[model samples]
Target chain A: MDLFISLFINGLATGMLIFLLAAGLTLIFGLMDVLNFAHGGLFVWGAYSGIFVYTWSGSFIVGILGAIVTGFVLGWITEKLIITPVYGNHVQQILITLGFMLVLSECIKVVFGPNSIPVDVPSYLAGSWEIGEVIVIKYRIFIIVIGLVIFGIFQYVLKKTKIGLIVRAGVMDKEMVQVLGINIKRVFLFVFMTGSAMAAFGGMLMAPYSGVIYAEMGMEYAILGFIVVVIGGMGSFSGSLMAAILVGLAGSFMAYYVPYLSLAVNMILMAIVLIFRPQGLFTNAKEG
Target chain B: MRHEKYFSLKNLTFLIIIIALIFFPYVADSRTLTILMTQIFIFSILAMSYDILLGYTGIVSFGHAMFFGIGAYTTAILLSTYNNTMMIFLISIIVGMIFAGIVSFLVGLLTLRLKSHFFAMLTLAISGLFLVVAEKWRTVTKGNDGFTFRAPDVFRDRVIFYFFVLVCLVVVFLVLRRFVNSPLGKVLIAVRENEQRTRSLGFRTLHYKVTASVVAGVVASLSGSLYAISLRFVNTSVMSMDITLDALLMTIIGGVGTLIGPIVGSLVIETAQHYLSGLANDYPIFERWIIFFGMLYILAVIFFPKGIVGTVYVKYLTWKSKKAKPQLPTQSVPLVKDKERFE
Candidate 1:
């Protein structure tokens, strides 16, 4: 029972990180119909930059803030430069974004040097609590709390705000929204930027969780984010959350029980989902 | 009428090129040049197979390396485990191709029903699964360190092997040319242009796609076998994403739909890679060749979207039309109508 709870918490924390990345990917796909493969590049950058600031300033909050700023800036640049030209063409978008992904990864090697960097949990978030044979890591609990808070905040904003309604409307029909006099283009830019920022924020949090950050981690986690997006259903926020948790739990348990299958478990789960429910676990909000 | 002529100018040009390449090993005598040419031939075959999916059928699969790896591993395992006789070498290629065909067929059936982005991501994930399997099944694959094996005596001779691979490249190219021009190929093209319209026309698009996938898989496996033979070694790197990206780059940079374009693209890229890496020995900055490669890729997509051959062909057509005398309105009307109907 203790092992199960510990595994469950671990999975939840990992799922939250994946959700941060997939939420942005699904939203960008749903609203703009643009699949940004370079979203992963934004993630690695967030980790590198956030960790750099954390070490320099010695404040975790400042590090998170730095990461968000970097995300917004990179998001704006990607949308304006790399993404703007290849809009509406899926093949070009995939190729161009893939190219950008390579550039981003290589640039990391250039900037941060070609070595993995180890990170430590913040002082406040270190250690664990033991409650009668049930021990809980503080960092893991902290991550779960942060993930839920972010989820709650985004959920509220998406449901209650005027921009949220506009974004949702844009997802359903960009032309209809445009005809109604909303600058759907600006909304697209906003969504793209926000999605990218979230990816970076996820990367920042993932650094301490993983303990080591490398240039290639972006591609690795990006694949996970893509799987989560597919399983959650593209453009569905809650779907991403549900699917992320499921993948996290599956991975967490499988690693402990069947080490040989851990690497392939996510792929098998995705294939099964693809074969049976091609629309993903939850249909897109727009479609639903 | 031009195509009907057996000895047309185009046909003659191709024949001359083939004859020249056949005599290349004798004339070059340099081992480095021969090796380079052989590498180009092998990759040209791989890129052309990719074109069948990406250009001819409008399907973008990111997991193409899986087929390549299957072929490489099959041949590598067979030759090392058994005797390296000529018969085994021949049988290994066939067996590898069959294995690749089955896997690709299954993969296509499972994933082709999804949208493009979903299909791409699924294939990538599946290929990653193959990589994991290869890594974990270290006893058979020898793990990431890989294993080297001897080939048949005939293949041990570089000159003989070079010609053999050249012949394979030529044969594969001609077969693919005929494939993309066949009626079935035309239907594939129709599907690419507009899947819904083709479906409305009563063509089973899925069947056509699966067929293309199988053909591509078999051809890619053949190249993988050839690659393993050329190196006398096999490794999990054969199935890496880098190999798939190379195919994609070759197809796009040469000319997507043009069968000959991938050959040209492979030549340009392989030569550039060779020179850049060679330069890396002297210049520290050149060590990061992939960064330059990535930049070139981005530039190619933005500037030469049609690729070298495609852009040149379009230009030649426009120039020829400009030079020709204007057609009478009555005559041009039928021509325009014919073109519209054909399209």
Candidate 2:
């Protein structure tokens, strides 16, 4: 029972981290129909920049803020320079974004040097709580709380805000939203920036959670994010959360029980899902 | 009906090129150049196989390395465990191609129905699964540590190996060209242009796509076998994403839809990589050659989206048409008379 509880918590924490990355990916794909392969680059940048700030300023809050800012600036540049030209062409978008992804990864190696950096959990969130036989780690709980709070905040904003209405409308029918005289282009830029910020935010959080940050981690986690997005359904917010949790739990349990099949498990799950639900589990029926 | 001419300028150019390549080893005594040329031939075959999907069929797969790795591992295991004879090598290549074809056929049926984005991600995931299996199956694969093996007696000589690979490249290229020019190839092109229209016309686009996937997979496996034989080694890195990306880069840089483009692309890329990495000894900046590669990739997509061969072909056509414009006035008089007669 103790092992199960700890495993469950571990899965939930990892799920939240994946959700943070997938959320942005889904939103960007949903609203703009732009598959940003370079999203991973934004992620690693966030980890590096945020970690740099954290060490320099000796404040985690400042690091998080710095990461978000880096995401925004990078997102804006990527959208304007790389994505704007290949807006409607999927092939061009894939090729260009992949190129940009390579550039982003190489740039990280250039700036941070070609070594993985070890990250420490801050003093305030270091210990664990013991309840009978169950010992709960504080950092894991902190990540879960942060994920839930962010999810709640985003849900509130998406449900109630004017920008949320426009975004939802854009996702449904961009032409219809444009017919209503909204500048859909601006909305695209705004959504791209927000999604990138979320990815960077996830990266910043993941750095300490994993205890080591590397340039290549972006690609590794980005694949996880892509899997979550596919399982969850493109552009479906709640679906992403649910699918991410499912994947997280599956990965955690598989690692413990069938160690050899740990990595293969995710691919198997994705293949099963693809076979059954081509449109994805959470895809809107109308869209399908 | 009048038969088409067989000895056109294009045919002559190709024949000359083939003849020149057949004698290349004799003239070029430099062992490094011979090896480099051999590597280019192998990669060119791989890139051509990719072209059948990305260029002819409009499918973008990120898991092409899986087939390549399958070919390499099959040959490696067979030659190392059993007799290192020509017969075993031949059987291994055949087995690898068949295995790749079956896997690609199944993968196509499962994921080709999804949108391009889904297909790309699923292929990547599937390839990653293959990588994991290769890494963990240490008993057979020897895992990431990898193992080296002796080549067949015939391929032990570098000159013989070079000629052998050159013949394979030429044969594969000619076969693929004929495949693309056939009626079935035309249907594949139609499917790429507009799948719904092709389906509405009762072509069953899925069958054609699966066929292309299998063909591409088979050819890619052959290249993989050749690559392993050339190196006389096998490793899990053969299944890595980098191999797939290299193939993708080669296809894109040469030309997507052009059969000859991939050959040129492999030549440009292989030479560039060799020289750039070699230059790392002298210039410290060349240590990060991938950054330069990425920049070149981005520029290619932005400026030369059609690729080197594709853009040049387009330019040649436009020039030919301009040159023929003077003869158009003579033909216009008949059209004017036809209009007058109709009125």
lDDT of 2 at B331: 10
Q: Per-residue lDDT tens digits of candidate 1, residues B57-142?
A: 88889999999999999999999999999899889999999999999999999999887888899999999999999988999998
lDDT of each: 0.88, 0.89
- Which regions of candidate 1 deviate over 4 angstroms? A284-288, B325-343
* RMSD list, candidates in order: 3.8, 5.4
Per-prediction TM-score to the true structure, in the order listed: 0.95, 0.95
- DockQ of every candidate structure: 0.48, 0.44
Candidate 2 C-alpha lDDT tens digits along A21-110: 999999999888888888999999999999999999999999999999999999999999898877777767788898898889989988
TM-score, structure 2 vs. true: 0.95
lDDT of each residue in B2-119, candidate 2, tens digit only = 2447998888999999999989999999899999999999999999999898888887899999999999999999999998999999999999999999999999898888777888
Per-residue C-alpha lDDT of model 1 across residues A1-288, encoded as one tens digit per residue:
999999999999999999999999999998988888899999999999999999999999999988988999999999998888777777777888988898899898888888999999999999999988889999999889999999998899899999999988887888888889998879989999999899999999999999999999999999999999889988889999999999899999999999889889999989888888877888843483
State interface RMSD in Å for all models. 6.9, 12.2
As for candidate 1, its interface RMSD to one decimal place is: 6.9
Docking class for candidate 1: acceptable
